[model samples]
Target: MRGGEAATLEAVLQSVEDPEIPVVSVVELGIVRGLDAGQVTITPTYTGCPATAVIEANIREALDQAGFEDIQIKTVLSPAWSTDDITDAGRQKLKAYGIAPPPKGAKAASLCNKSVAECPHCGSINTREISRFGSTPCKALWQCNSCHEPFDRFKCH
Candidate 1:
């Protein structure tokens, strides 16, 4: 991806943070699809996600800063991204940041919007969706009945 091996490029990519969720890096969020010589592939949380462009810009800047200006950034939409793409570390970060992580197999259950989101604050399952949209388009506003605290949960994509 850079002058030689892909691991160096990976390290650089791993440092690129997600703008919407600053607590986790793009890699942790599974935005990075693959790395290889001459190119770095990525997939956004969703195709029309507003942060997609910003994410590419941020990655470009990071690559440039890490001397990977020659490596091209490629975005792919096919086989589209899913909430399952989120890494375990990313899930933990979301919880620590006071956001509920999407439940496993959330994608198929998305249409119902009935997947129970564990309350990050009180670890309770009693939560209700307050809004379909959250601070960011990729997330939904949810309120934990146990803690009475509102939190963002990545929509089951």
Candidate 2:
């Protein structure tokens, strides 16, 4: 595979959206670690994330559509995934999709301090944590004071 082929493969992978978060593609979310002519390696944003199966299926379909019938999908657990790996564009897309992005600079240990995850609807910093687990185990539920709207907070890993 050469220039066009490599680019096409990349594009196909980029088109594979995260099943859980449809707005952000695996590529944009920084989940796809690497893509080769015959293989794709990805690290889950959350350990034991249920979306792993869907992501794998998407990768297989994407590469197969790109003419790569033989695929090797590897899930790497080392270096563990984190919300910090998500790109700025991916964060924006997440917000656009109505899901609040993770708090910037909000380390896993600093859950008490208000990070950068402003309410997507009201842009308010005064938010209350409702639950540690949201719709998915990867996110937390939060309620904004300004809008009184409840939203999911992408957990800051």
Candidate 3:
């Protein structure tokens, strides 16, 4: 693609929101890994998550509507995806939506130790996991000790 065409494709893709998490865009979720002449490479947040297909369909629809129907959407799972891949803007969006963002570098430590999830409402670290699963498989249900507010925390990958 020409420079201008590539930039337009990116802008269109960035405008596509995550089907499951409407508050954040697919770009902010780190789903759009690369763009080429007529292809978009993406890595879904989770392999088995039900939203993966919806996300791709949304992107496809958006691209088609934007008059870039020729652009192909490709899924690449080799490297996998980490919560750490989420952009800072995405993290803020999640917090604003009452979902706790995973801590920096928590992805590596999550396997060995429990990472304290900060309360998005009260900014308290004293939170307890209510369940390993939240509204979605990619999150955990947690309650803040300080505010007693239950919220969803993005799971560490």
Count the clashes in each prediction: 0, 0, 0
lDDT of all predictions: 0.85, 0.81, 0.87
Misplaced by over 4 Å in model 1 are 1-4, 110-112
Model 3 lDDT per residue over 40-73, tens place = 9988887788899999999999899989888898
Off by over 4 Å in 2: 107-116
lDDT of 2 by residue, 1-157 (tens): 5788778878888899999888889988888888765678899877678898889888898788777887788888777777777889999988887789875656656553345458889788888888888898778888988899998988887
User: Candidate 2 clashing pairs?
Assistant: none
- 95, model 3: CA deviation in Å? 0.7
Q: Distance (Å) between predicted and true CA of 155, model 2? A: 0.5
What lDDT is obtained when candidate 3 is compared to the true structure?
0.87
lDDT of 1 by residue, 1-157 (tens): 2355577778888888899889999998989998875888999786678899999999999999988778899989877888888999999998899888877677776544666888888889998999998888778899999989888887777
| TM-score sort, best first | 3, 1, 2
Candidate 2, residue 112: lDDT: 39
Candidate 3 off by > 4 Å? 110-113
Judge candidate 1 at residue 2 and give its lDDT: 36
The RMSD (Cα, Å) of candidate 1 is: 1.9
Number of the top candidate by lDDT? 3
